[model samples]
Each structure stands twice: as structure tokens, then as C-alpha cells.
Target: MSMIKKRRMIEIQQLQDDSEKQNVTRFILEALPQWFGILEAREEYITESVNKMFFCAYDQDRPIGFLYLKETGKDTIELFVMGVLQEFHRKGIGRALFYRAKRAAREKGYSFIQVKTVKMGIYEEYDRTNQFYQSLGFKEFQVFPMLWGESNPCQIYVMTL
Candidate 1:
């Protein structure tokens, strides 16, 4: 199946500073935890002092979606959080953010990408999340109980570039 192509007017760029980062907060907050299953799981973490990699999807000058990532190893990265405003979902914004991040990470010499979410049988939202990652060529790497507890059953997926 063909994935959506990013609109010509839309740009995906790395978040450069505090102000550009701040602009996407409202859009990120629009998605529920059921949607992306962020570790912070709320808006309060957007500005938190975590070592993060961010890419924002902008339509013209409006921030529509974002992806948050962190280095888990010298050559591996974790997709920490990602979301698009409900009105903007499935319009290729999230897919654009994802592929941009992947390309950037690969260019930076990272070979592996990983993202964690609530396991499939537990949350309906995360089931789609897992499927989305899989569609992008990520595979099930492992399932462990340490991070989010037993019921959550953290599912980790990995992709190699």
C-alpha cells in the first residue's frame, strides 16, 4: 500500500530552540494518552528538561504534529512521544514526522530505531500505534514488563536503517 505523501507546502524540521519547541505543545496535548502512550503522558512533559530529539510537522507556518525521540544507545534511538492534533491526523502529518525522524537518525549514523507502547491486547489505541510502526517496517523486538508495569506490558519495536 502507498503511504501518504507530505504536502508540498508542509515542512518537517528539527525543533531548534525553546520557542519553536513551545509552539507545538498545544498540538501535542490534543492527543490522548490512549493515542500515543507517552512516558510523561501529558502536556507537562513537553518543556521538561529531558534530553530529547524533536521534529515538528508544519503546514505553512502552523505546527500540526511532532515526534519526540531519545538516544538509547550509541547507535540506537527511542521514539519517546509523537502526536498530531486530532483535526490533522491521517493527513500524512504523522507519517511525515516519522519518516523525517528516521532519515535524520540514519544520517546521524544511528542504525536502529525503537519505540515503546502499551501492548496490543491491552489498549485498543496502542494496537493501531503498533500497527503503524510495523507498516513503516519496524518489527517486534521484545515485550517486557519493567517500564509501564504488567498490565501495560511495554512493547518495544525496532527498525534498522
Candidate 2:
């Protein structure tokens, strides 16, 4: 049987402790496999204790989505990773986490926010992800054929804040 989604009040904020890092790691492992199943060589960011800009979306204190941001340059922040639990998809949790990160970046005077993902249409899940970010005003910045190797061309999106 299909389950119903509950109307939720989600709070977005920076991840503040090792416990939250664990929570986000669990969430990503659970949520992203559907999209990134082929890429087993997971990056160190999620596996290690988060010592970077990390944020999460919580529903009554339970984490539903998480995002990590890093200052890639003097005036730009790169969205290193983001994931929303499968069951919580399409419920605005990801958007909440993204905007919270964007707000924080903007407040810190970052000139741009960028995200790199596997080129959109190559994967169904990432296609939706691209659409979501485009809806948030992030436009195509560049596509690097060798960034993640030929199979996983990296598409970078950017929004000028």
C-alpha cells in the first residue's frame, strides 16, 4: 500500500554537531542511491565529519533533507552535496535546505552560488534535480566533460546573488 505524506513544518539550519553529520550521512545513503547508484566511489565529504558549510531540513526535529556548501573561491559557494529522503521527495524539503544555504551564503556576501551535478538528462533523477534548481533561478554555467570523467559529465549551474 502507498503511504500518505504528512503536512510538515520543516526547519532549516546549519548542521552543528557530529550527531547531525551522522544523521545527514544516513539520509544521503538512503536517499541518493536511487540517483547515484552507479557512483559507488562516494566522495569523502559525507563520509567524514562535516567540517564545512552543512545544512539540513528537519521535520519536528527529524532530518528529511540535507545540503553541504563550500566556498570554492573568493566570492562563490559550491553546493557540494544535497539529498532528500525518498519518501520526502517533492515536499519542499530540498528547496528549504537550498534556500537556507543560499540565504546564509548571501548574508556572508558570496557573489554566486553554484552546484555541480551529472549532466541533467543523462539520468532521470538528476533531470528532475536540474529542473528544480533551474526553477530556483540557477542557470547553466558550464559543462565539464572530464570533471567526473566521460561517463559522468559534470554540469555546473549558477545563480548570481
Candidate 3:
């Protein structure tokens, strides 16, 4: 049997409109099942904050992924959240989104980009996720146990450019 190939039609661009915002939020909600309970902040709050400086990935005019960054300090930026539609995972969309975020951070004069992840039983893909960041040159700065709360231990990583 012959397999049909899916074209890689991904495009990266800054999320600038309300429709894009809704698409991103919906994608996040669908991609991250545990976000509602584990994350202390509301999705809308995070989306609004990130919308101020965010980039999205679209495939064939459909929003497929997003990467959000925020200036945390004078020379530092935080990668708040990044995810691709579940079906679109493992298709290089994450890497493309990351590069876009990094470019934006560099443009903003940030010297470092940071990300934090929690160590929870539900996050079996943590190792893979961390490895992906490290592959992109991020270094582990700190790993705090139960930092967010009694049950949420976190691993903080940073990439210096």
C-alpha cells in the first residue's frame, strides 16, 4: 500500500488579531488537558498576557501552534507556553515556533530566554520536553522541589544567547 504524504505548509507569524487569539486559546485548551487544574492562572489571563508578544504557526490557513514569550526583566525573557495541535505534534512545528519566539526575544534585546516546567506524574513526556529545550541550547538553571506548591515541583531552564 502506498502512503499519502502530508505537505508541510507551516507558516510562522505574529498573532495580531482577535480570531488568531481565539484559535490559539482553543488550541491550547485542546492540547493541554491538565492546564485547567495544574496551572494556577487562568488560560484567558495567560493568553491575554502572551498575546502582547506572541507568534503563531499556521498550516494552510489554520492555526496549528503557538509560542508565547514575555519580557521578565531588563535582559531576560520568559517562554510562558508553547504547543502545537495534538495531531500536528512531532512535525517540526514546535521547533519552528521556538525559533520564532527566540527571534522575537532577540529583537527585543533579551540576553536570555527562560522556561519552567513542573515535575508531575501526569507529565510523562517531561524528559522529552526538557531534552527538546536542551537540544536548542537551554541549560538547566535550577530544579526546585515543590516550588509552586506542596505537590508541584519545577525545573527551570534558561538559554543564553
Say which candidate scores most in lDDT. Answer: 2
Higher-lDDT candidate among 2 and 3? 2
Ranking by TM-score: 2, 3, 1
How well is each residue in 24-67 modelled by candidate 1, as lDDT tens digits?
75456655555634555465557641446788887788777888
Clashing residue pair totals per candidate (backbone < 3 A) = 0, 0, 0
Best by TM-score: 2
Q: What is the C-alpha lDDT of each candidate?
A: 0.77, 0.80, 0.75
Model 1 whole-model lDDT (C-alpha atoms): 0.77
Colliding residue pairs in candidate 3: none
Off by over 4 Å in 2: 1-6, 38-40
- Give the Cα error of residue 99 in candidate 3, in Å: 0.6
Model 2 RMSD vs true structure = 3.7
Question: Any residue pairs clashing in model 1, and if so which?
Answer: none
Q: Tens digits of per-residue lDDT for model 3 on 1-161? A: 99999677789998767666656756665656654344445455355553467788888788887877867799998887777677887778989989888887888788999998765353667767777788788888997886777556788899985
Model 3 segments beyond 4 Å from truth? Answer: 1-6, 34-47, 120-122
Better of 1 and 2 by TM-score: 2
